[model samples]
Target: MFQNRHNLSERQVEILVGNLLRYGVLFSSALVLLGGVLYLIYHGKETPNYQIFRGEPPAFRSPEGVATSALSGRRRGIIQLGLLLLIATPVARVAFSLLAFMRQRDITYIILTLIVLTGLIISFIAG
Candidate 1:
């Protein structure tokens, strides 16, 4: 006989998800703050030409570029990485929800969560 067939309660799972979101936000904020400080330290002395609006340098354009620059201690790339983390947090939450729904054996919710997860994946791929 399977002991405690009813494992995690819905409320417990909800609380776990809430904590995930809270911690994710906190971590992303910290990364952004650190990036901001680094940005100031690196660029504070540079004089910008306000008359002509300039775009970000080549190293900040794409994900690979950002990662490469970030590895090289570029603050803009660090900020981009932080923003990527912020973007990924909700996707991670959805992934966790999918697993939770599977564990609960709630068919309706499991299907619904799967659909949502699939949509998220498709959007990411299409983009």
Candidate 2:
């Protein structure tokens, strides 16, 4: 039984990663679409004022804020959350690659992936 529990092949890992990316994108898109529809339903009739410019609220800036607003069913917050998810997808892929490299005992790849993951994290945090 222990012998039957073998590690995944390279191709299997690739397929799993592909599926993860595909599903992540699809799910995020769905959220964005849902949020857009709800936003339109709520504000479609409002007239636009081109001379005035406004930015996203503070509540939609941070991940925690987005999550809170999204949980409260705020349309803009839902959209922001979807965008955040889109950004996170690639970061997640890199993280998964790091794990895969570790599992495969590929030191070079593990180090490279760790560097990339670290860069991504730093960029997000620094921004």
Candidate 3:
């Protein structure tokens, strides 16, 4: 029987995954909080006009818009970008799992993870 020299123990893999999730959440949370603070600083004094259902300004509706807004120091854009990051965290975890499974020579898990990744991509693209 042949042994893979580079294979890691399950404990090490779990630790890496745990750290990935923890750091991803923390970093995304910090971004959101910073955006919130900036938003409050910029618009804290504005009076609420609750009678009308005015939609979000055009700049906040899409990823590109959010990025542009963030670059221009728009608080709302920053918030949206943070939200995007939050959404991406799990996707990133899945991707990382796929890589880990590949590295571990886990054929079953690799295939399963690939299916999951495909579904995620399709849903995001078509839904």
Candidate 4:
């Protein structure tokens, strides 16, 4: 007679391959999600209604038969959330990666942290 005993060895994997899989998933998904956030920010930045430097509002009749600001409340709401996500994601990613590195002393965490931190700094400075 045999029992369905738990075999810890069955679940164990080679360390390097395991680490590679983990870091691959983390960085790949992070980059993919970051791309989406960047797209949102880019589109928000390009929208005519979101442009802050437009000196003259176009002459257009409102529903009340008067000129209305292109800076509509709905546009502001979308733009605000887009910009916040664009700015927040990378910052949070770097902070969490740094903390992970501190806890585990992993080089993968260090590398990812450096890349994200540099990206965030360059973004604010160049942007």
Task: Write model 4 residue lDDT over 1-127, tens digit each, in one string.
Answer: 5533233322332343355456655654554455456556767566465655654223321222111221342333333334444445546646655765655567886787888788887886676
Superposed Cα deviation of residue 51, candidate 4 (Å): 14
Model 3: per-residue Cα lDDT at residue 59? 90
- Name the best candidate (by lDDT): 2
Query: How many steric clashes between backbone atoms does each model show?
Result: 0, 0, 0, 0
List the pairs of residues colliding in candidate 3: none
- Model 2 clash pairs are none
Could you give candidate 2's per-residue lDDT for residues 42-117 as a string of tens digits? 9989999989889878898789999999999999988888988999999999999888888888999999999999
For candidate 1, write residues 20-89 as lDDT tens digits. 8889888888878899998998888999889998887887666788788778877877888788778788
Worst 10 residues of 2 by lDDT: 1-10
In model 4, where do residues sit more than 4 Å from their true spots? 1-78
> Rank order by TM-score, top first?
2, 3, 1, 4
Q: What CA RMSD would you report for each candidate?
A: 3.6, 3.1, 3.2, 13.2
- TM per candidate: 0.77, 0.90, 0.83, 0.35
Rank all candidate structures by their lDDT, best first, as comma-separated numbers.
Answer: 2, 3, 1, 4
**Residue 92 shift from truth in candidate 4, angstroms:** 1.0
Per-residue C-alpha lDDT of model 3 across residues 16-76, encoded as one tens digit per residue:
8888889888888888899999989988999989999989899977778988998898787
Which model, 1 or 2, shows the larger TM-score?
A: 2
When 1 and 3 are scored with lDDT, the better candidate is: 3
Candidate 4 Cα deviation (angstroms), residue 114: 1.6
Model 2 TM-score, all chains together: 0.90
